[model samples]
Target: MRIGELAQRCGTTTRALRYYESLGLLTARRSANGQREYDESDLRLVAQIRSLTDIGFALEDTRPFVECLRTGHASGDACPASVAVYRRKLAELEEFIGRLTAARDRVRAQLDDAERRSRPCKR
Candidate 1:
């Protein structure tokens, strides 16, 4: 398939596909006419890349997994280093959630206080 078709199938833009190629997360062959062509395997790779990226994996972080996948590794998690990377990512996500939760609670309390102050005084 062409770049546009691949992007449409993956629910992404052609620019994103080109970016993925630049990041080494995806690959395509140039046709004689100079257009990029992709195969079914590339589609699957794009899906995996999209999922990992959505979960906050940096392009560099995802590179090893993508290489492992391309080389027919049984599982990306089977590598000890990859496991450690995921653990670190999980820890970071937890810490971010905690901070966001605290900020949200503080904002909610401020909103409640403002609401109380805006009400008319009761007898």
Candidate 2:
């Protein structure tokens, strides 16, 4: 298919596809007319990229997954490089979760203390 068709099928814009190409994460073949062309494998690559980015992975981080697919892996995460990216992303998320949890606990404690101090004075 053409660039437009590939973008439409991938639920993205042609501009984004071009950006991916510029980043070396995606490549398109040139037709005899010099228009960009894509295949079903390109569709899978875009899907993998979209899925990862939707779940908080950076665009650059999706490179390994794309490369894995390009290398003929049945699943992008089948490669060690992709797995390493997954591990790093997971660790980053865990650290963020821990910090958020601590902030939440601190806020809860402050609210409780304020409520307790605002009560009416006893005789």
Best candidate, TM-score-wise?
2
How does each model score on TM-score? 0.73, 0.96
lDDT score, candidate 2: 0.97
Give lDDT tens digits, candidate 1, residues 1-123.
Answer: 999999999999999999999877888999999999999888777877788889889877776666766777666555666777788889999999999999999999999999999999999
- lDDT, candidate 2, 1-123, per-residue tens: 999999999999999999999999899999999999999999999999999999999899999999999999999999999999999999999999999999999999999999999999999
lDDT of candidate 1 at residue 110, scale 0 to 100: 100
TM-score of 2: 0.96
lDDT on C-alpha atoms for all candidate structures: 0.85, 0.97
Task: Tell me the TM-score of model 1.
Answer: 0.73
